[model samples]
Every structure is written in structure tokens, then in C-alpha cells.
Target: MAEPTTRPRDAALGSGPGRVLLTVYLIFAVAAGARALVQIATKFGEAPLAYLLSAVAALVYIAATVGLAVGGARGRVIALTGCSIEMVGVLVVGTLTVTDAAAFPDDTVWSRYGSGYGYVPLVLPLIGLWWLWHNRPRDRA
Candidate 1:
């Protein structure tokens, strides 16, 4: 009989520290998505850009959370993609919100580098990338 396949300890997605990470991501996903839904449903015209950006941020968070919770090669890729875009989004949006406050009269998840959410938005991507890298697939001899 063939031995069962198993991943390394670090490759566990929803285990140990990954469980904490997953929980946090889930929270943000709900918060950002709900906020966006409310903003768009109630007063999108008041701040269309902010509302749309919030929606996009919500999607990214959802993707990241799902990917991490479903750990595998595909999951790693998804998580990495989501995390990468998240980092870029936070950097660009943070700069825009700071340099041109008028452009962003309202807040998105990335606004002020995630200051509205205690900066977890800014740091989450970095940690996600690290997790992905740590669990990266190894070449067999």
C-alpha cells in the first residue's frame, strides 16, 4: 500500500497560527463587505469611488480568507495573489487618501493604510505572504 500524502507543519492553512489568521481574515471580509453593501445600497452617489473601492477591498479580503482556509497548492496561489494585490491596494490607496484627502472623502479598508481598522489591513498582507512562503512546496529529490 502507498503511504498517505501529508504536508509539512508549516503548510497547514487553518491550523495553529493559521487558525488565528483565518479568523481575522473572516472578520475583515464580513466587515468590509457589509460596509460596502450598506454604502452602495444607501448612498453610493454620495461617494461612488469610496463605495466601489470598499466593495473591491471586501472581495479581496473574502478571497484571501477562503484561500487560506482551503490550504493546498491552489490555495497558496490564491492566497498569494490576494495578498499581493492587497499590499498594492493599501499602498496606493493609503497614499491617495493621505496626499489627496479630497479625493477620498470617505474611507475604504485601505484608507489611511488601514488606520480605520487599526492598520490590520496594512499588516495582514505581509503576514500572509510570509505564511505562503513558509509553506511553499518543496522540490522532491
Candidate 2:
């Protein structure tokens, strides 16, 4: 086998549009994490479900941000999983909060399709997925 070159074979994941995605994920990670922490610390008893969901959302955002920053095939897979879960979480949580606000009793980052966050949470995953796909490595001719 030929010696491998140190130069990057593919573009860095965080290059170009991925940078924007990474920034968004970072913002979400911090925002959601802080919110979850405060809610859990200040009033867990009042809305355990919502607060727990908030923590989960924060974790997902953190994972996604890290994955995107890491780059490469493994990172893409990790980010893909995180984005998929985030999309589902937002949809399910958004619906639950909308259909029956009584159960949640509080808002999470995903509440109302991320209405609190200007619906960016609702749309971020889709954008992330597209960015991943757009940047997927292809066989060199």
C-alpha cells in the first residue's frame, strides 16, 4: 500500500456550511443545558418530565455539536444519529405540548416545536441532515 498523505482527504466537516451548523448546535447545547440545569435545580418537582426532556435535549445538542466539530466518517455518523433523535424529539415534544399542555406543565427547548427559540430547534435537524448529505464523501474517480 502507498504511504498515506497527511493532508486531509476530504474537506473538514466544520468547513463552509458545516461551520454554520456547528455554531447553531453549540448555541443550542449551551442554551438547553443551562435551561435544564436551572429548571432541575430550581423546580424539578414542579415539572420533572419537562425538565428531564430539557436535559435530554441539551445532551443531544452537545453530542451533535461535538460530532460535527470532530468531522470525518465516524463524526458524520454520530452527528446523523444526534440530528435524527433531535428531529424526533422536537416533533414528539412539540406535539405533546401543543395537544395537552397539562402533562408537560413546563416548556423544554423542544416545546411547541421550539417556538421559544424562534422555531430554530424545529428546523435545525433538517438543515443539519442536509449539510451532512451535501458534504458526504464520494469515491474519487
> What C-alpha lDDT values do all the predictions have?
0.88, 0.89
The runs of at least 3 residues in candidate 2 whose Cα sits more than 4 Å from the true structure, single-residue gaps closed, are 1-11
Q: Which residues of candidate 1, in runs, are more than 4 Å off?
A: 1-11
What tens digits encode model 2's per-residue C-alpha lDDT throughout 23-87?
98999999999999999999999999999999999999998998788877777888999999999
User: Which window of 10 residues has the lowest lDDT sum in candidate 1?
Assistant: 6-15
Which numbered prediction scores highest in TM-score against the true structure?
A: 1
Indicate the residue-level lDDT of 117 in model 2. 97
Estimated TM-score for each candidate: 0.92, 0.90
| lDDT at residue 119 of model 2 (Cα atoms) | 99
